[model samples]
Target: MGEHWIDVLPVFSDYWINGEVFTCQVDPTAQAQVSPWWQVPQRLIDQLLKTDPGPVIAQALQQLQETRADLYGRFSPALLEMKIRHLLVQSHGQREGLMARIVTTLESE
Candidate 1:
């Protein structure tokens, strides 16, 4: 299956699936669709948040650099990169909002 971005946090009442794109408590089956990223195994998300994301990004960049030889002629590199970066920015904002809700929930707990 492919991935799509979801902008909302799925508490007991709301959530996301890997393929579908909506947030509602209306479906009893909604819980099944929650993404693995959001479910976050054994609640490691709390521990992960304590660390900076900088090193993660750096490692990703390094990996991409190392794989550059294998990535030649994949697409219109310039246009694809621009579009992907723009989309990533938009997704990042959406993720930020979702995280805010999650953090609020965690704090209140």
Candidate 2:
């Protein structure tokens, strides 16, 4: 079968920026081998940070947990949990960094 491709752009809070198109190749039989198609833009991150981050973080955590459950028996659950915990910690640090940047920007004005 021929490969199928779809283009996508990241959107934040109903706003979308132009000029960025991510092409994702879809292979019906090779779901596990498919790679991520796009990078999260810095502007999108900034816009998300400007709003309440709780729902976003909660959604991401739910997805991570679901993925871990889906991949059960393929790897050690303890190891996967450890990695997920680390990622959550990193997300917290990212929030702090974003807040710091906002404060700095405000102070400079």
- Highest TM-score: give the candidate number: 2
- What TM-score quantifies how close candidate 2 is to the native fold? 0.26
Off by over 4 Å in 1: 1-42, 46-51, 69-90, 93-109
Give lDDT tens digits, candidate 2, residues 1-109. Answer: 1222233322222332356544444555643433466567988787665565554445544554564344433445455444444444566536444333433333343
TM-score of 1: 0.24
| Cα lDDT computed for each candidate against the true fold | 0.41, 0.45
Tell me the lDDT of model 1 at 64.
42
lDDT of 1 by residue, 1-109 (tens): 1233343344454444567455544566545555644544544643453343443334333444455433323434454344334433455523334333433333343
Q: Tell me, what's the RMSD of every candidate?
A: 17.6, 16.2
Clash pairs for candidate 1 = 10-14
* Model 1 lDDT-worst window of ten: 1-10
Q: What TM-score goes with each of the models?
A: 0.24, 0.26
